[model samples]
Target chain A: MMEVSPTLPAWVAIVTSILVLLGAALTLIGTIGLVRLNNFYSRVHPPTLGTTLGIGCVLLASMLYFSVVKQRLVVHEVLIAIFVTITTPVTLMLLVSAALRRDWAIGDPSVPVPPGLPEEAERPEPLPESDQPTS
Target chain B: MSVLTRRVLPYPLLSAFLLIMWLLLNQSLSAGHLILGSIIGVAGGLAISSLQIPSGQVRNLHLLVQFAFIVLYDIIRSNIAVTRIVLTPGRVAKSGFLYVKLDIRNEYALAILACVVTSTPGTVWVNFDSAKGELLLHVLDLVDEDEWTDLIKNRYERLLKEIFE
Candidate 1:
């Protein structure tokens, strides 16, 4: 197993350890929320926690560890942070919109009925038995 | 002067950002790196210019910085709140959709607001109707509808309006 160098300062090691543990804990909590949330909309909220702060904490730890041990200013981890921060929202918006569309299509009354569609037409009745098994 | 600058660098801010990003990615501050990064930045700016994307002028840099700090603070606070919500096993969270009527009309500002809202945990930007200037957001632990509305309007929209409008 790899070990921290004895020459390295204790505080750096301590901070890194704390950051890693906090990040892992937050990620665990996020996954637990994903599993425990009752509905799909609620479930969507938890994963953002892991993606935002969870990865943020872990990346900060890595950055600190590498910069301290290498004795240099290492900040390339910020690239990942920036990329993740920007991309996560785009993907999440796409997913939420898709889910909303699916809900609308299925005529789930819980979701607001989209404009121009009557309440009865929200969920179109199933086709006759003759057209059922075309595949 | 304006015409020359527009012809050479259509998107000055984007060019600057690209240059900074290049230098950061290269992890160097040498003369050669600066020249190369500038070249890439110029090329990127010109390429984007060819797309003819509509650009909104940012009127206030101070407000932009202030808004960024507010977003960072909110993200941290929400992270804690969400962590607590997730850890408490039996506590039920009230998640619901909210419609916010927006007065800010700038597209760039609206896009940034959406990104900020969606990126923060406990809130998801679900949809927007451009015609009505209305945004649909989902909140994980909604307590008061008025509070959320005020939060979005006063906290973000006001600042965004100052910067972009």
Candidate 2:
């Protein structure tokens, strides 16, 4: 933990501490859910709680603390917000798609055959992404 | 000069966004930094233009802003809901896949919806068969499939249609 600035207002300090603690707690919960969840697909949803709100709370705390201390707006946290929101989807989508492919190959019962593909034929190889919907 | 300017700043919107992002990241507004940031911004826009990347337009800024607020509120709300599910004692969270058929065809709107849905706590977008306008999602809690469909279609998709399409 960084040293609390002596000049920082008591209220700002208190609020910052609360936000930091909250961000940490929420992130811990997310990781806990990650361990507790049963399968890959369901596991995907829990960590997002940390990514969306956990990161958000910490960034807000940083922004607020810096703005109060420096007496100028410090909003670099928005960059994280923007980048995280942009990249998380691509990363998660690709991971799930890959997992789905492996699950299909292994004949995982919980995983449904990807829609619009032939139901009878088991696809071991990756299908091209642009395949038109059969239905 | 105009030709040079056009070459330097091939995409004004992208350049402006880059410049703002640079300033925010650096947390500086000094003249030297400003000049350097502007140069980088212009260079970025020029570099991207050479790639001939496609872009999308926002038809309504007001609605976009409104939609942003709605997403913020939902993220917070869902965060709480998901937190409770995780913390409750002996509560089994039944999860399942949800299929949503979307009508909004604009690529930008679809991209935004993807981000919104994925980042929300309880829902993770798995796949979107764009050719069929069908989206498959994995949800943390399986409460009501229709309710989720209605939430996505009406809450975000409708406004996204207005904003992008």
Identify the candidate with maximal lDDT: 1
TM-score of chain B of 1: 0.97
Candidate 2's residue-wise lDDT over B1-165, tens digit each? Answer: 499877777788889999898888898899988998899899899899989866777889998889989999999999999889888878878888888999988877888898889889898888888787888898888888888999999999989988987
Q: List the lowest-lDDT window of 10 residues for candidate 2 chain B.
A: B1-10
Estimate the TM-score of every prediction. 0.92, 0.88
Positional deviation of residue A80's Cα in model 1 after best superposition, in angstroms: 0.8
Which portions of model 1 miss their true places by more than 4 Å? Answer: A114-123, A126-135
In lDDT terms, how accurate is model 2?
0.84
Give the alpha carbon lDDT tens digit for every residue of A1-135 in model 1: 988878788898999999999889888888999988888889888988888889999999999999888888888888889899889999999998887666666545577655445536647554555533221
| Best of the candidates, TM-score | 1
On residues B79-165, what C-alpha lDDT tens digit does candidate 1 reach at each position? 999988988869989889999999988889988998899989999998777778888899999989999899999999989988998
Q: What is the C-alpha DockQ of each candidate?
A: 0.62, 0.59
Looking at model 2 chain A, which ten-residue stretch has the lowest summed lDDT?
A126-135
